[model samples]
Target: MARRVLLWVGDEAVHEAAGRVLHSVMDAQRAEELMRSYGEQLIERGRQQGREEGREEGLSRGRAEYILRTLALRGVHADEAARERILGCTDVATLDRWFERSLNATTLSEVLDDLAQ
Candidate 1:
């Protein structure tokens, strides 16, 4: 005598449906393939985000350094403490105004004034 299996599709019970359709399927191998594909996709997305973050950091540092160098050329002398303050600033609009004033600022006070506004 053969064994029988029943599966409920909607409102009717179908006999031997799974045994007839999925009798030769491999479940473990298919699951492993899907897991590996998902891991690779996650790693690629993380790398792209890291690269973009690094690019933004480098641009901000470069702009800050340019402002300091321009201030030095214009005879605006800032000590180590003031230099640290300027480099720590992250606002782009404020930095742009400071950069413009650095070209003509004759004293450190004038440079700080531009940064304040």
Candidate 2:
């Protein structure tokens, strides 16, 4: 029987092997705990990044809308291409400058000028 063979090998040898196995199991459990903690931190960081990107995108959309509305209220007729350029803009300062120009613009081109820059 396997028990008889193990007994014949003596108690000292059996105890040493059993101790090694206990240590190996403990080490494996500690490594697993550390991995789980690290994974949670990475997930939190990804979520934070997503929120920041969403906020920035919303700001850009708001700026673009403000620019278009200002042009319309001033009776400036921006064609389709000019409308696209205004709506597509994301730079807040540049959008503000264009909105200011719209107040004094007699033609769509005046408000949309320097847009290529």
Candidate 3:
């Protein structure tokens, strides 16, 4: 029940406070063990979330770079502002669209035409 309540609260500070209270009231060694277990679980969850976020960020960056490379190969000159727009974009679908456009685009304007809509 206490574990359920802590999980339901879903706050790290609350969990720490609860662990402290449990330690004060329960057998010190047992409480310490439980706290360690909970802390490990929390750390693992954080690491997993970080890994997922990093992977998504990498995918976004790779797509953006590929789009830029494709534009360069097609002889479409992207000015500084356009380059920033492409690099800053996090939407994979938009990047894919831009890449498809670059395949046949004769100018930077043509590559970014959908953005105007």
Winning candidate number (lDDT): 3
Select the stronger candidate by TM-score from 1 and 3.
3
State the C-alpha lDDT per candidate: 0.64, 0.69, 0.83
lDDT, candidate 2, 49-107, per-residue tens: 99998897788778777777777787777788887888887777878788788777888
Q: RMSD of each candidate?
A: 13.2, 16.0, 2.3
- What TM-score would you give candidate 1 relative to the actual structure? 0.64
Error of 1 at 70 (Å): 0.4
Q: Return the clash pairs for model 2, or none.
A: none
Q: Alpha carbon lDDT of residue 97, candidate 3?
A: 89
List TM-scores for all candidates, in order.
0.64, 0.64, 0.83
lDDT by residue (tens digit), candidate 1, 1-117: 012122122223242343334344546565445435544555676798899987876777777788899887876778898788788877777777777777788887776664446
Error of 2 at 42 (Å): 1.7
Give, for candidate 1, the lowest lDDT window spanning 10 residues: 1-10
lDDT of 2: 0.69
